[model samples]
Target chain A: MESHIELSFEDIRGKQHATLIHFIGDLDATNIELVLEKVFNLINEGTVNIIADFKQLRYVNSTGLGILLHFSKTAREKGGCFKIANINENVYEIIEIIGATTLLEIYDDVDEATAALT
Target chain B: MTTQRMEIDIQEVPESEGVVILHFSGDLTSECVRRINECFSAVGKKGKTYAIANMAEVTLISSAVLGEFMGCRKRLIEEHGDLVFCGLDLEMRTKLHLMGATKIFRIYTDIRTALNSYKWEIERQPEKFHVSFPPYLKIVPPLRQLVSRIARQKGYGNRDSFRIETIVDEICNNAVEHGRPKADDLIDLTVIIDPDKIEIDVRNMSDPDKVASLTAMLLPEKTDTDKPKPDVKRGRGLSLIKMLSDGMSVECTDRGTSVRVKKVREE
Candidate 1:
């Protein structure tokens, strides 16, 4: 699938603690690495908390879900939090069925997720 | 310019009941998946949960499309709906069946039948021999005995029987761990003893991510990978399976995940 992943704040302020990522297009074996690379870069850049905006995410395969698990775990290990927001009904149910929702701190939208992170 | 390898047309008739039919013509090689996904995404955005993909016009299909189907199925099922395929030619149907998609989808002979049959779910038809196992105690011995009995019934010699049993061992071992099934879940073991080959499938309900990792792990590296060290914790079962079976593959479906291994009997 043609997965388009965009990470906001290519250039970030040194004091900025939280980041927002807008996930578009399909998330599968093909596109997950590109998406994860950006997520990892943000984490490595010392973004304490990240909000993965899934407002436009159309498809998420198992690999994508696994990437999310890795994202959450890495953020937690670093004393920060990784959460999700604005996911459609399908993505929400997929995560819920897989029992990964418990591991993720999810919110309704990016604004709510960011407000709580701050 | 020569014709494109694929053409995708979305048939979104007003009364299709949340179903969108993607009609594909031309070759179904890997390059076509991106086009399929783009049209599929459009359907998803419209809140359509069911799809009837008509591939009759397509001359051929590939295993890559099977993986693509699994992705689309997950998205649809996540919305409490399903995806069905129809009008696939015989070669494609045989390929789909070999890939064990019959267990995942309710494929029909035509679009009308496919659309009408979506009222309920459909699973694979019964095979000649089948067994169900609980992932308790040692799983190999019982499965070995079962395979041996079938092999003997089919007049398989010791060498052939042993080979089949070995494949069973490798696939079942991986299924037990990676399947991560719940208490109520049972590992379904099925044997399809065709005239010339015996196909074994092990099905279990597990996390999609787990299945994805297993598929990725077992996928033969484009460049050869070095053997894992003794202390290494992974890739052992998949490697053993690839060594033993003539063919083996895993698929994660809306129902669950299955690992299928086939061994052809020598004349």
Candidate 2:
């Protein structure tokens, strides 16, 4: 069965060209391939500076967390950065438990992530 | 029919003493009866009488080899033990049925079923329960949610219940990611809930090599400075499980791997 997760992209024209991808449901192994493909497609299309808005994301497992980290690394490799904003407590707790709070760039909200995008 | 030579490899099933699994491959013909007999006799000499004949790769078998098989089974049964057959193909089943050997033999589709046929009694306590499912990621969410609900039902706080759920998620995800399980394999989850502490065990069938690499990754010997860099994508699931659970232990065996984690409720 497929996991219930949706991704919507919004382009932000500012200090750097960035794409804001909003996660609407749980991120997991079932839907990670699609998420990865979308994120890589953005990066290859010169939208390397990506901001992930996790405000609506309800749940995430280890597999989902791994891809988020991968996106951060891949975006940075192409002279851009991957930032996350508006993370819920449950998902943030998972990131803290895994000690990845410092690995991936995290902001308090979309505005904060956008202001810091480079 | 393909290769005239037959190959046999034997391994003792861990945690099940006196039980050995014999993997048979290639053609079992008259030339190989003596060798096969010697293997069976050698296992019997080692006092391992409960044998499982894995014929998943056998292409052909002569009448002499079939006779030898029956003889070995009879000898083991006489000693109050038995030999079982598993992973038999359609051709092999037809051959056995045509020879009327299926009536006297206990055959199963895979080793897991054959192992469970032993009917080893598990101690079912009031506060403990077990669940087994195929190794699929889609099956993990409900399992984790069930663990959390159980913890909450046992009076754990919301945060503690979430921690229990997180622990199950990471361990089960690790099993699916690194266990290298086949389609027929299963992942077993056992939970024991107490008033103050909860224990969870996740076990999955995997080969020895995958188990070895998982052991190294989960229980790495790296210092703080040698940890994965900020941009690292993997190698965090095991750490999350370790950090969330109060105590954790991993057991790796030839047949499978088991990870046990303990969580204590906070005040």
Candidate 3:
């Protein structure tokens, strides 16, 4: 099934941009490629600071993580930062155990991650 | 396949009406928190002081689900109910204990004993078997559903089934997305189900060096005064698998990398 993934962008402060990508429904192989494409597009446009708001994200598999890693690398190379905010603790732990916390910043709230970008 | 409605029933105990019994079933994930909250809210309406979750029929609960449990407990206490738990299988209990919730929730072997201190009747053990799958990127949800059904037939509940499904999805997807050189490259998955526990073993013929690098990449050495740079997406999958399963073992031999996940059945 196709996932209803939503990506919202907001300019937090200065060059610090917060793109809130809400992953709704299943983020499986069916639509992960599209999601990755969207993420790359945002990074290519220099949308540096990103906060993936996973409040609405129901599920995410390994392919989803691969996409996130790809974008995180791109963001870092461009001197930008990528973070995830407002994630459910379960989702946060999933991200944490995968050592995503080591590679990407995780915030309890969007404000905190946005503040870091500033 | 029928999409089941989430349901929770809370009843006041006769001896200690302060203790509420929460019976829940179906998939308990982040999305189901609102429903769980509603159940807690209903229990709060009764004005009881303490509560216990009757997890007998509950098959699986994710870390997110556990968070919701804690969150609900906090909410209940704020309204005068102390939260506890009953009917957790060894797998669920172990996960909760590992997360330090065993200290948080008062766990019992069964609902009747938890409710009235009556002799708890433990059910007979279920048959167990192991099955393996080849790693590939496109995960077959139906196959996962079938496995879950098999588990349920063996007396595992929906919650446990969901846990198995989630782990399988994570491991198989990793093999497909990162482990294999091509889409057709096989990722082997094996599930061993016995009365006591279910053990999942997944193997893929990927580059061992790449696997080692992936492992190293997961635990980056900390430098002075600064946090390590986030890799963005590549790292969370394995970590999530580790967090969800009771125990995990990762081994990379000359041929491939193997990940084994075990979930014990509750009595």
Candidate 4:
């Protein structure tokens, strides 16, 4: 399956900029490189306040989850806030199992997740 | 004395005074597994239960294909008919014997012996079932589990059932990890089941050149000291596949590579 990892920048009320990134398909060792590269590029471009939408992701293996964790840490260290939103049940359980929910702000709705980043 | 190198011809064998023989040729790797399954399905639908797979043309047969042959034999048995092998080269015979399939299947030197043996049985069991699968990898975990469920339903007990599950997972994982393209690649899987055995054929669209490297990495050479280095962590996946499967065969061609695995039901 093809993954469309899109990063869009939005100016929220002229006070903050939010980068919304959507992940799709199975996130395993196979395609984790693509995700990491995209996230790193966005971070290097100073797009720190971000929301990762996991709505279309069906499964996340340990390697995939690890990449997400590393990206969150890198974003945080760079003074940018990272939030996750629209996580489906399967991916949500994986994220929860890995205790990522406790480490990062997770929201059910995109608006709330983006709002948290702002 | 001349070596009398083996020669094989794939021809239709007529059995029971009317049935035709479906012959198989070349190596039975992952690529040819689907074709073999399709041939089985086509012959099965014709109400011809007894048939001979003339393997004289097959020079190199993989373990996966051998397993698939066992599965086919089990399938024919349930219909009161049987599948027999004829024209196996010496190397093929030795390999089959090593895998302990010599007792499980009736091997014949020629097609006539196999046909004569199945003539009466074919009369009583004319109905045959055939199944086929495409060459792609699908990530439907439920469907993957469903294959094992069908095997269990056929009375293949718990241990063999779990074995099937693990073998399928490892083979499919290899295709997903190494066979298909990075973003849009898919591994094609085809599974068939009868009363006695289950045959699974997996095809991955991978570069054939890499297969040798991958296989070598998975089956590394042992050092003279008889000790494995602690840091070398390769070949685990292939070792696991070999351990779990009753028969495993791999073939890499210009088009793609195919792996065939077969698990037989215990009586």
Candidate 5:
């Protein structure tokens, strides 16, 4: 299969404290780099706080998990926050399996992740 | 070589004779998986489940076929039968072993040996049916319907069966589109269903480079894409297959490439 992800941002709690990245489609070795590079660019832009929305994600492989970890780690190094929202059951299972479930702040929805981070 | 679309034949060993086997030849793939699903649905309609699959002549297989195999095996086991595979070459056995499927399915060296393993009641099986179609894009839908009907007939819940249908749709579309098929070019598909497992094979005349590219990505542990480029289309079909099926394999040859996929149903 191929890979597709739409990258976009929204402000949470009417404030621009965090960059809410909404991801759609499969995330694997094929396209994980594109996503990570975007995250790096967002951090460089000084919006260190990130809320990754995965509600629309169809799939994620091991490499994608690594990129997610790298995203969070990079945010932590910058003294900012990295959170996630709306992760579907399938991707969540893989996340849990990799023992990274506790590595990030998980919210049931984008609004929650946004509110908490902001 | 010859542009033969594909063919599906259900060869049932006579009841009073030897063990019952569903023999499949030609290309076994997602498109063919539907036919295999239909055969089992037909078996399910008759309220039977004991099955053995013979893959002596199967030259190709796909991931959807693997998913179907596992689904059917689980169904058969629930009904008090087992899905056993026989007549596999060393390469096929290694493929199953590598995918960690050998632990689940009963493997045999040959039909005679597989039959000798147990005395199965020859359940007056239905006559085998065969169908062939062009590799053209237009006919893919009806082909997928055959698999969807099998899932429904096998009593799969709506969502579960739909997943199976989608897998078939994705692979067949790829097979038709990616195949550097000349005019009148055909891909062969075959599905064999038994109480234990379902087998699907797909064969296509493909450029060696295309085969190499797919094979590399198919192995995830040692993986990377050909190169990072703007993927105009992105929905990892191969990854989805790896996630869903019990096992899969790709065989590349000078003439063409064949892929076989098998799945062991959850008990």
Candidate 6:
């Protein structure tokens, strides 16, 4: 019984320091540090404006939500932004219940999140 | 000689909306008033107005704790909630009656009828599932999946099923991370699927300090501060479980901690 999370990154074609990361598999306490390390590494390399694609994300718990909020705050402090798009209904419900919808930037689609990135 | 202290166990009664059961064992006297008050007040703090004090195991009782219960019952009534008693042996019953406390509180022979008084329909033949494994992070995902699948088959909608999965994942993950179970320690997960809701109980070996911290986090000391601030990177799992579940309670003893959560199926 091994839980896995895969992170794949794509650079927005014309954006200078923005990247889109697609989350795959379950994000939880077991694998949160891995996601944290990867996101921190990207931020350290000057890719602060990031968009997370949750279309492929099957599951996420509070630990996962914590990191997402951490990323958003970290990116904003560096004059960048962490925006989420294509969030499935289930994931959105958890985020909403925890009252994180206002804390993190959310868009209905990836293009909208990307278009709003400054 | 060391005096035996009382053990206070708090549980949310099944299907009783906003009601809880406070089970007291051993002698409950003035020495145990503070512990008793915290447990009683904690129930009121959870927005629960009604409680059933199961006194079957109590061998001794004192006026101080009885006063504390009277105070709690008064507060519950003020808030449109109440405190009742069940499973009282004849001796305990006579104690309450002699003190005139019986007039102030509703008394029941057992917990089942007490819950019925609240109009809580007890489920019949609820589907139950149990699993136990070493406290390992890897085991959580698959277990959550299996539980979520069970919820779906039991008629929970996708949203409710996801809530069930999140509750299981968050609690199990918290158990492993905070519990820090030894290699041989096992985490037990039990889920009951009723026609109208799903109930889950997860137990893990934990020290008293860990249990205290988890309890504080699960049920915040006050309702005003119930929601965890969005910025903190840690200590949000228990809060999330609290928010998403219909009813939740924790019982901690020296040996281990058990967290029970309930989620009602959305119509």
Candidate that would win on TM-score? 6
List, residue by residue over B1-267, the lDDT tens digit for candidate 5. 642233655555565232346776776767777788887777666655666788777776566776788888898878777678888888877877887778888888888766655452233222222334556755655565576566556444554444454455545655676787674667766554433444456677776777787787677573324322222233345555555566778888775777666644342
**Which candidate has the top score in DockQ?**
6
TM-score of chain B of each: 0.48, 0.50, 0.44, 0.44, 0.48, 0.51
- Strongest candidate by lDDT: 6
Give the residue spans of candidate 5 off by over 4 A: B1-264
* Candidate 1 lDDT, B1-267, residue by residue in tens: 344478888888575567788888888778777877887888999988888888889877777877897898898899877778889878888888898998998788998767645532322222367778776425554575578567756667765675676567556656666666576678888888754678998888877878877777666672234434322323444554565568888887877788888887774
TM-score of each: 0.35, 0.62, 0.47, 0.35, 0.40, 0.65
* lDDT of candidate model 1 versus the reference: 0.70
How well does chain A score by TM in each candidate? 0.86, 0.95, 0.82, 0.84, 0.91, 0.97
Order the candidate numbers by lDDT, best to worst.
6, 2, 1, 3, 5, 4
- For model 6, residues A66-109, the per-residue Cα lDDT tens digits are 88999999999989999999999888988887788989999999
Cα lDDT tens digits for candidate 2, A3-73: 68999999887655678999998887678898888888888888888889999998887778989888888
lDDT (10s digit) by residue, model 2, range B171-256: 88778776765877889999987677899999988777777766665555743454456666566677767678788887977657
Candidate 1 TM-score on chain B? 0.48
Candidate DockQ values, in order, are 0.01, 0.31, 0.25, 0.03, 0.05, 0.46
Model 1 spans with C-alpha error above 4 angstroms:
A1-118, B1-127, B222-226
- B-chain TM-score, candidate 3: 0.44
Query: What are the lDDT scores of the predictions, listed in order?
Result: 0.70, 0.82, 0.66, 0.62, 0.66, 0.84
Rank by DockQ, descending?
A: 6, 2, 3, 5, 4, 1
lDDT of 2 at B73: 93
Put down candidate 1 lDDT per residue, A75-115, tens digits, no spaces: 88888888799987656755564456777888998667767
**lDDT, residue B88, model 6:** 92
- Clash number for model 5? 27
